[model samples]
Structures are given as C-alpha cells and as structure tokens.
Target: MRIGFGIDFHQLVEGRDLWIGGVKIPHHKGSLGHSDADVLLHAICDALLGALALGDIGMHFPNTDPAYKGIDSKILLQRTYELIKARNYRVVNVDSSICLEAPKIKKYSDQMRSIIAGILEITGQEVSVKATTTETMGFVGREEGLVAYATVLLEPVKVI
Candidate 1:
C-alpha cells in the first residue's frame, strides 16, 4: 500500500461562491483561485496524485491555463482519479480535514463524504471528512482563508 498526503489553502474573498468537497456552501466569502476554489477537493486531488508520484495539481491543471478558469473542482478530482486508475492503482480509502474559522460545517460532513466517494468510485464508508475551527489563532482563525488536508491509501489493482 502507498500512502499520500496533501494540503491546500485559499484566501477568502467576497463575490465568489464557496465550494468544498463539491458541496456549494453558504458563506459570506468564498475561496479565491482560478477554479471554483474548492480547497477540500484540491487537496484530495493532490493526495491522489502524490500517491502515484505524479506531481501536484498545479502541474496538471495550471492556473495560467484559461481552460481551467472558473472550472468546477469536482471535475479536477474526477480527472485526477482517472490518472490513478490508468496507472492500475485504486484508492483503498481517504481521510480529510477542513480547517476554518467561520460558518460551521459539521452538517456538511456526510455530503462531502458522499461526493468524494462518488468521484473516487469508492464507498462512502471509505471516505472520511471532518471539519474544525482554528480557534481564532492564525490565518484560518483570523478568517483570512480556509485550509484542507487529505491523505489517501492506494493499492495495486491486481496482486502480482
């Protein structure tokens, strides 16, 4: 089994829609980025890519590319998983955590898990999503932005 870990952060700004783990969340400010700025999904994608030593999301989906501008992060996640599948690797499970300061997200955990599982073609039970507050300590606590961390376990598609 191979273990991969990834983390992502995005600044929060007004006038953008907040998306996390493919779930559109209601919030005063949204993550700022070239894409829909779903930090959670981005982190997951990075983790999957890292598991295969394929580099990070930016290498595959460069922000300078207009094609990815304002795109949905869910699509990115799907494509990342496709790369993994092409290499004959399958995700055994994924665990993730989102850290923020405002607009509690406890209620959205299940939905996030479901969405992630669907995209990864795995069972919801194999995907775990969690949320936490920064306790007003740093950038996340100051409400400047949000961050997400993801770890994934991968195994060969077939035993050799």
Candidate 2:
C-alpha cells in the first residue's frame, strides 16, 4: 500500500462555469485557469501522481501549452489514471477535503462524489469528499478562491 497527499487552489473569476470534481455547480463565480480549474480534481490528480512517484499535473499538462486551454479537467484525471496503470498500480481509496466559505457544499457533495467515483471506476464509499470553512480567515474564507486537499491510497498490482 502507498499513500500520497495533494492540494490545489484557484482564484474565482466571473463569466465562467463553476466546476468541481467534474460536476458543474451553480455559483456566481468560477475557478480561473487554463483548464476548467476544478481545484478538487487537480488535487486528486496530484495525489494519484505522487503515489506513483510520477512528476505532477504541470509536467503532463503544462498551462503554457495552448492545447490545454479551456480543457475539461476530467481528461486530465483520465490521463492520470492511465499513468498509474502504466506503473502497475490501482487505486484503493481516496479522501479529499474542500475549503471554502460561500456556497455551502453540503448539498452537492454527493453529486461530486458520484462524478469522481464514476471516472475512477470506484465505489462512492471508497472516495470520501468533505468540505469545511476557514472561519473567515483566508482567501477561501473571503470567497476569493477555493482550495482542496486530497490523500489517496494505491496498491501495486501483482505481476503475472
């Protein structure tokens, strides 16, 4: 068994769709980035990469590259999955947390879980997502941006 931890944050911007964990959410502002800027997905991607001793999301998908502009993050997640599989690893489970003040995430937590789980081909019970507030203390508390942290477990496949 292997364990990896990852974290990501993104600034909020107007005139963009709010996306998290591959699901669009109703919100006034969305994360700004070359990709969909799904902070949660990015964090999970990093955790998966870290688990396999691979470089990182930026190494695989550079923001400086135009091809990734406005790209959906699920593609990145899929690519990450492939990278792990190439190393003969399979996901055991993942636990993640989102930090934001505005937009209570409780309502959409289940939806986010379902979407991410489907992409990972894992049961919802294996992927845990939790949200919390910083108590009006930082960028997330001020609603300027959102942050996510993820920890994942991966198991090495037995070679036939």
Candidate 3:
C-alpha cells in the first residue's frame, strides 16, 4: 500500500461561493482561487497524485491556464482519479480534515463524504471528513481563510 498526504489553503473573500468537498455551504465568505476553490477537493486531488508520485495539483492544473478559470473543482477531482486509475492504482480509503473558525460544518459532513466517494468511485464508508478550528490563531482562526488536509491509502487494483 502507498500512503500520501496533502494540504491546501485559500483566502476568504466576500463574493465567491463557499465550496468544500464538492458541497456548497452557505457562508458570507468563500475561498479565493483560480477555480471554484474547493479546498477539500483540492487537497484530496493532491493526495491522490502524491500517492502515485504523479506530482501535485498545481503541476497538472496550473493557475496561469485560462481554461481552468472559474472551473468547478469536481471536474478536477475526476481528472485526478482518472490519472490514478491509469496507473493501475486504486484508492483504498481517504481521511481528510478542514480548518475553519466559523460556519459549523457538522451537518454537511455526511453530504461531503458522499460527494467525494462518488467522485472517487468508492464507498462512502471509505472516505472520512472532519472539521475543526484553530482556537483563534493564524489565518483560519482569524476567519481570513480556510485550510484542508487529506491523506490517502492506495493499492494496486485487484483483477478479480
């Protein structure tokens, strides 16, 4: 089995929509980025790529590329999974977490799990998502931005 870890952070802005793990959350501020800026999804994509040693998200989807402007993060996630499958590796499970100071996300955690699982073609039970605060420290604690971290376990696909 191969283990990979990834982390991503995005600044919060007033105009953008708050998207995490493919679920849109009602919030006053959203993550800022070249795309839809779903921090959780981005982190997961990075982890998947890392597991296969295929480089990080920025390498595959550069911010300078105009085609990615305002793109939905779910598409990026799908492409990343396709890369993993092409390498003959499949995700066994994934664990991820988000750091944010406001907008308690417990109610939406299950939905996020389902969305992520669907994109990865895995069972919901195989994906885990958690959220926490920074206790009034750093950018997350200050509500200036949010961060996400993901770890994944990958193994060769069984040809049963």
Would you list the clashing residue pairs of candidate 2? none
lDDT of 1 at 42: 98
Q: Which stretches of candidate 1 lie over 4 Å from their true place?
A: none
> Per-residue alpha-carbon lDDT of model 3 for 1-160, expressed as tens digits?
9998999999999998999999999999999999999999999999999988899999999999999999999999999999999988989999999999988999999999999999898999999999999999998999999999999999998778
Q: TM-scores of all models?
A: 0.98, 0.96, 0.98
**lDDT accuracy of residue 113 in candidate 1:** 93
> Candidate 2's residue-wise lDDT over 1-160, tens digit each?
8898889999988898888888888999999999999999999999999987787889999999999999999999988988888888888898999998878888888988888888787899998999999999988878899999999999988999
As for candidate 3, its clashing pairs are none
- Which has the better TM-score: candidate 2, or candidate 3? 3
lDDT of 1: 0.95
Regions of candidate 2 where Cα sits further than 4 Å from its true position: none
